[model samples]
Target: MGWITTTWHRLGSPRWFYGMMAPWQTGFGIAALVLLAVGSVWGLVWAPADYQQGDSFRIIYIHVPTVIVAQSAYMTLGAAGLVLLVWRMKMADVAMVAIVPFGMAMTALGLFTGAVWGRPTWGTWWEWTDARLVSTLILLFLYFGLHALRQAIPAAESAARACAVLAIAGLVNIPIIKYSVEWWTTLHQGSTFSMRRINMPAVMYLPLLVNVIGMYCLFGYVMIARMRTEILRRERDTSWVVELVRRPDVR
Candidate 1:
């Protein structure tokens, strides 16, 4: 417990956190690249085609991972918001900002891929009445609104507080999105991956598991890189930042 507390306190220091994360960022980035490359080839080429959807079902490799990442990113934002509001941690604010763009991109990609998958499967590019589709679209809009709120505010602290409030409020939608398919009639299929039972075959799911893990690693790499940059920008006037900048060995 003492060691854990000490490490936690050290992590709260921007300089320490930045230095510690550099090596992890590099390791995760390389792993993400390799895993994503292998997973993509395996999923798109080597995996057996769907008995019904055929080759088009391969898009699931991209779609499922992005959607999962999108949801996870928003959850991270909500947790960061809580930390910023309760503990007044500047690192939490930086994390929230760092997560936004990636979340938005993933949400957008999920929507696009869903639409492409829908066109052939559902006979329509979109369905307004589909609860899952509507909820997911709402999730995308929430990301847009959060980004706009962050940018529109001029004062740094005020902006962070406002975004934090919004992030916390928007978390109500996450459960709605998750349960939408089950709660209402919709074209969207039920989850393929579940803790209770495995709905998909091993051949199809293995590459998907790889892609999901790779995407998560990619998110971590990007978040750490962005957080380090944000910390430097926010703490440029601090002594540690100044000394770190002057050091020849520090990259």
Candidate 2:
């Protein structure tokens, strides 16, 4: 209990948080590369072709993981925003800025792959009226808004507050994205796998599970690395950062 409490307090410190995440970066980074490779190879080469979509269905390995993680990454932003608002932790704000670009990239990738999958499946590359599609488009825009907000405000705390408010408010969109297919009559299918249950066959879902885990590890690795870099920039004048910067090993 004491150790947990101490660690929680130390987490508020940039130096402590930076050092604490070193092992997580190494572990998750390596897992990301290995699992992504294994999952991609297995899904593409071994998984049975769909009766309906055939080889085209293989795109789900990439599409599912990217979209899942993109939604999750935005939730991370919302959580960070809450922390910043309640605790005024600058590190939380650092986390938000760090995740925005990555989240945006993932969202874009998901949309692109969805389009590719749609072309043959739906006979259309883009559909502005689809609930799932439109909600996701709005998500991407929310990320863009946060990025632009950061650039618009030069004052650190002021930017943090504005971004925090937006991030918190944006939480509303995530659920809409998750439930869009069900809430409206949409072409998109409900997800086939969840942590609580797998609605897919083992042979097909196993590789997807691997890719999901890999994508999450990749997110962790990227987010932590970005936060570390941001911490150095934010705490440039701190003694530990100065000392670390001076070390011959770092150079």
Best by TM-score: 2
lDDT at position 97, candidate 1: 88
Per residue, candidate 2 scores C-alpha lDDT tens digits across 1-251 of: 79997876888889888998999999999999999999999999999999988899999999999999999999999999999999888889989988999999999999999999999888898898899999999999999999999899999889999999999999999999988988999888787875698777899999999999999999999999999999999899989989998999988
Candidate 1 segments whose C-alpha is farther than 4 A from its true place: 248-251
* Span of 10 residues, lowest total lDDT, candidate 1: 7-16
List model 1 lDDT by residue over 1-251, tens digit each: 79998986787788888889999999989999998999999999999999999898999998999899899999999999999999898889999989999899999999999999999988998999999899899999999999999889999999999999999999999999899989999999999887898789999999999999999999999899999999999999999899988999876
lDDT agreement with native, every candidate: 0.93, 0.93
Candidate that scores best on lDDT = 2
